[model samples]
Target chain A: MGFSISVEGGQGEATIKLVGELDAAAAPQFKEAIEKLAVDKPQRLILHMDQLEFMASAGLRVLIFARQKMGADVSLYVIGSRGPVLNTLKMSGFHHSVYLQDTYAPE
Target chain B: MDKLTLPAVLASLAELRRYAREAAAAAGIEEERSYQLQLAVDEIATNIISYGYKDAGPMAQIVIGGEITADVLIITLEDHAPAFDPRTRQMPDDDELSKPLEERTIGGLGIYLAMEGVDRFDYRREGERNLNIFEMRRRNG
Candidate 1:
């Protein structure tokens, strides 16, 4: 029903936790968070999407934006993406760019 | 079945999605299936609003109707904009998928997802009207 984003960062890695529906309305919030995180220059960026129920194309744009902003030096990981969310990523070809896992373990 | 009618524009997206959720549930789609139906509908509707209506100005009207049987859900969107068949648009091929970030082009990715989300997609023209039909198979309960 709503979208929420929380970012956790320490050492050389950063993880972003997303909860609720992510549509065009929430994409700006996502973009802001990623843009802010890009400045920190974390070597790894992980997105925890276990609690995310929905993701539209607008939200997908933010993921692409994050990849472009972070450059190749940053490895992006999406943890716990399934069902329609996973399908969207695969369809957009984003699955190839990031590591997708059923669970998140700090590496 | 239910119909949601509005002008084909970005502002109508929220309403479009809201109507889809209700329609999907009414059509007996389970939670997971409902989600894909909503996203699929939004993607196609967005296409109609963004590209289908490019020359129709801001007042182009889009009418979306839904019907569900015991086995499937059908969503049909009709607009007065220029006829466009998303099927003709090329999906991002494996070559593009393998490209580096800077070399990738995202031209039809959104529509590609829309097509992949649904079981069947069709586009046709009748006079000045363009019709896009989408179908989703419902899991046996």
Candidate 2:
């Protein structure tokens, strides 16, 4: 299947849930969400990707874009990414740019 | 061994994936070697579409072939793009990943990862086309 994204507010942060395959086809939608979040300028951004099964290099590019659009002061969290999706991040060395956790803890 | 041409778009990734899987299986590639070959092909094919031929026109085509000899999987990809050797590109430094996205470089990491994933990688500029050959053997072998 293709990909989908859902953004919601949680406590003091904004959480974006990504589902399905994140590839070149899904990058535009992903980019739009990050741009919208940049307007709100949340203190933290949490990406829930437990259901994300795959990620292409284009998807990784969007993740990099999100990191830049959100700015350095904003904390970015990626939760529950596994399998090929997580390997893409680890292989590209993106696992270091964001905080990765099995579960998001409300602070 | 099989060959097919699809538009060099992100939409074509599924086609590439299937090609890699079927080709590896037909070659009787081991599980670990199959996975590594798949990853390497994905990275290279994606790079070809994204960077090698970023323009719109006759979509760049990929020729994939594989064989198993003595428990080793040998896959080769031939494409008509500029003479760019992915292997010669430098890998990202340990600290490069932590930098801000804007400060970080965009390309090169995929090629680096592909190199690391396979047991052997070789590239050559064959006349008008770029030829890349990758090999992977059973880890315990």
Candidate 3:
């Protein structure tokens, strides 16, 4: 019903936690968060979408925007995306472009 | 058939999605297919509000309705916007989809996903209205 975004960045890694639905109305908020990350251009961008219930194309657009804005050198990871959110990404063929994981565990 | 009319604006999209979801449920659709139905409706509704009636304001409206057939569910979205059919949009082919993010353009992705998500999609112009029809076959357990 509602959307919220929280970001944390340090050590060349930035993590964003997304909750609720990511529809057209919430796309701007996600884009804004990505814009801020663009400034840092962190080596890794990990998106925590375990709590995300839905995602429309607008949300996918922002993900595309985030990848382009952050540059190709940055590794984008989508963590815990399931159900509709995962379906949207896969349907758009976006899942091929990102690292999808159930958890953000680095070895 | 059940229908809900909403102002053709971004804010009205949430309500329209809700209507689509409920209609899918009424037709005995499961969660995954229901979500696909919702996405299909949301994409075209967005195109209508964002492009069709760019400056039409609150006077412009979108009508969303659905009907349940014996083996299929049909959801329709009607708007008084331009005659542009979403089916005409250039969809991203496999080569384009396989390209890296930096090489890709965001245009037409929504339409591609919308059309792909539904079992059947049709566009029709009925006088002053543009109707987008989405159909999904009901699977029996």
Candidate 4:
């Protein structure tokens, strides 16, 4: 499957839901979404990735871009990532950089 | 063994991954290992298309072939773009991987995962072709 991304937000929180395969071809779109979200400077960024079946190094680069773009003060949460998507995050130790949860339970 | 040749472009990655996954399954590779193999192939193939074929012109092609031996499943990626060896790419060290988000660099993560995900990864250059070999040990059940 090709990649698709959507953003939902209100106030200080924003959630980006990513679906389908995220390869080099789709990384730019994701990076663009992050760029748009960074403009608002939300306090919290949540990535919903349950349906994101595959993620390559390109996707990882964008995750880094999103984190840096969001800055250190913002909290980033990754929810429902599984299979190869979860494996990529865990293998690259990216799971440590963000809050990983089965569901979005904001503190 | 089944071999396929496709344009060395980003769009061909999905079909390449599907080919790898199906080959792994036919070779009796488990689900997790199959995904790893797929990732490994995608990473190297991406590098080949993105870097190797950067200025090699429009007709550049990436050839992917799968071989199932008695004990191992091997997938080979060949490209005529350049003789770049993915193993030579510097991977992120432990210290680098543990760094804070803002301080970390994303370079080499793909090659790192590609090498680490598979049981064995090898690279070689034959004449003008760059061959990346990814291998996984078949289960003995």
Best by lDDT: 4
Q: Per-residue CA lDDT of candidate 4, range B77-133, in tens?
A: 999976788878899998888777788888899999999889899988899788899
Better structure of 3 and 4 per DockQ: 4
Please state what fraction of the native interface contacts candidate 1 reproduces: 0.34
**iRMS (Å) per candidate:** 2.4, 2.6, 1.1, 1.1
Comparing 1 and 4 by lDDT, which wins?
4
The runs of at least 3 residues in candidate 3 whose Cα sits more than 4 Å from the true structure, single-residue gaps closed, are none
Candidate 3 residue pairs that clash? none
Model 1 chain A: lowest-lDDT 10 consecutive positions = A88-97
- Candidate 3 lDDT over B1-141, as tens digits, reads 768888888888888889888888888889888888888888899899999999787799999988888999999999999798998899999888888877888899989989988899999999999999999988843
TM-score of chain A of each: 0.92, 0.91, 0.94, 0.94
Off by over 4 Å in 4: none
Better of 1 and 2 by lDDT: 1
lDDT of each: 0.79, 0.76, 0.87, 0.89
Colliding pairs, model 2? none
lDDT of 2 by residue, B60-103 (tens): 67777666677666777777877778877777876786665657
TM-score per candidate, chains pooled? 0.82, 0.85, 0.95, 0.96
Which of the CAPRI classes, incorrect, acceptable, medium or high, describes model 2?
A: medium
Docking class of 3: medium
Please list the Cα RMSD from the true structure of every candidate, rounded to 1 decimal place.
3.1, 2.7, 1.5, 1.3
Tell me how candidate 1 scores on lDDT: 0.79
Query: Which candidate, 2 or 3, would have the higher TM-score against the true structure?
Result: 3
Q: Write out the backbone clash pairs for model 4.
A: none
Which candidate's DockQ is highest?
4
